[model samples]
Target: MPYVPPPDLATLSLPEIAALVAARKLPPVEQWQPQAVSDSLMVIKADGRWFHDGGEIRRPAMVRTFASLLWRDQAGQHWLVTPFEKQAIAVEDAAFIATDVSEQDGALAFRLNTDEIVLAGPDNPLTARGDAETPALYLLVRHGVEARINRSTWLQLVELAGDDLCLTSQGARFSLVPSA
Candidate 1:
């Protein structure tokens, strides 16, 4: 018999399929952007058990979820999860926007707008939406992503505080204090 694709496959595109398997289909961690349509990176196992759906692995997650796995978090905060290494980035977490990695002197270099970097602090304070105060856009790491920062991907990590916030994140790590 000829193999048939699932009915929903008709509504998807190759890029869409790739996004579900990896990349921007899911929202970044620590940011409260609107939810996406699909949030899954399928992993097909070697065993024949998971022929179509893949093998023993992380189940399909809803794209709208903040926890990366589930949309709702018990902590009452939205967070993003990475399947690559089972890592999670809090909704309040932030990173700078970086261009595609380019090779420099045989090394990979990352670049970002000085203004495009900011922390997603607890709430909107001095800056407005699309404002410089927004948490630095995070890098959507691939499931199998691993690199040594060949060219030292420069980043200015900013800490998120309340409406009146303080920032940090280069060589120092600090804890977040929640609002009561």
Candidate 2:
């Protein structure tokens, strides 16, 4: 997708921008072959803060806009891909953070830092690293991209964990720990 700034960005509300972002179709980055590989100073920290040139990107709109253009190539490399250009960026961890969560209609829904909503299920399954007491939780967001579930959200999910270490969302039960 091309990075076209909205003409009235100053006037457009966050929800409006989010709607536009959600409505746009991303380009087939896998098919794009760019000869120039430029180094981007942008880095997504482990806590999901985006930094550029050693400074935090304070604008949520800018961060969310850039996030819409993010892509991961088959070679396991991350890039900010556009129709006309591609730049490599650094990711200390997952590119996004699930900052809030709620249970609705028997399913758990998460609100990402980018202001996008994702439901936990087979398509966006939850996974954990480390042990039961101190697990690092993650939720798949998009094409091979994931968001780290923040501590609060993880705690909420933990409360839902059953005796078998399984979580039920939207009537589907998912095992948080491997069965013996």
Candidate 3:
């Protein structure tokens, strides 16, 4: 489907817009089973920067709006999905990045590149990949969707690491490193 900006998008505050996005009931793309695929020129870089036609999408709001429509199918393909159409896009790594993090009420809250907030714990767990020297951390953002932990956020999380190599949030303990 062709993209349409909300009529009040320009007038709404960030929180209001976030609420509006949360309230949306997107079509079940996972169940759509589309047999046709059309490639788009958009690419989400490994560093969580988005580009279209080789130009960086510099506007944060525009990036967030596009991200709000992102979907990943069972085949592991990513798309910018709308109710009427789905456009395939390339993702070098995760679709979004956790650019900022904070702890509140015993939980770690992450602010994604798209301006979406996620609380990390059991439901939205944190995990690290790669070796200790170059570990890559990630956080679950939504249904089968994850955001790469940016360098600064990774450092912040590292600071919370316990002697046991575990991080506790919301009364849940997550191991920062896999057990030997």
Candidate 4:
């Protein structure tokens, strides 16, 4: 069946967005304990582009499949794992990009580059990094993997934030900018 992207987040309620997030069944990469570690020669650029060797991975399906298999180790290394083997992949910034965001009820919903929906809350909290002059926002995806909020999405989040520059979702509060 052809892939049908989820409807606009503005039209979906919090329950509906949560349902969309729950529907995506990602691979259990953490369960795979493959000892064979090798380099995958793949690099995820800061702009959310995936490149293998020297060529860009153009197929969206292929990228999504690989993304499903991604796992980040405790050492902050990115890997593509299977039951048989695990391969290291370089990441310039983050594994995924939060291409869009929406406010629903009292929660924040983010749409990743892989078309995955992530609802910000306690389990998947928002974090701010970088220096005070240049703040970067990240959303915990799964198993230590994070999606960096892109420029446009960051702007949207800023607009959604309160005058104190804080955004609250699911009882969790996050600062839009890094505190000095």
Could you estimate the TM-score for every candidate?
0.17, 0.76, 0.76, 0.96
Candidate 4 collision pairs: none
lDDT of 1 by residue, 58-162 (tens): 322221132233232455332234433232232222222243233222222222221111112222111212334332223323222211111122232121233
Candidate with maximal TM-score: 4
Taken over the whole model, the C-alpha lDDT of each candidate is 0.28, 0.75, 0.75, 0.93
Q: Higher lDDT: candidate 1 or 2? A: 2
Q: Which residue pairs collide, candidate 3?
A: 1-85, 106-170
The residue-by-residue lDDT of candidate 2 on 17-90, one tens digit each, is 44654675655666676777787889999988999999999988789878877887677677887666789989
Q: Which wins on lDDT, candidate 3 or candidate 4?
A: 4
After superposition, the stretches of candidate 4 with alpha carbons farther than 4 Å from their true spots are: none
lDDT of 3 by residue, 74-162 (tens): 77778877665678889999998988776654667777777666667778898778776677888877656689999988888778777
Report the Cα lDDT for residue 49, model 3.
90
Count clashing pairs, candidate 2. 0
Tell me the number of clashing residue pairs for each predicted model. Answer: 14, 0, 2, 0
For model 1, the local distance difference test gives 0.28
Worst 10 residues of 2 by lDDT: 4-13
Evaluate model 3: give its lDDT: 0.75
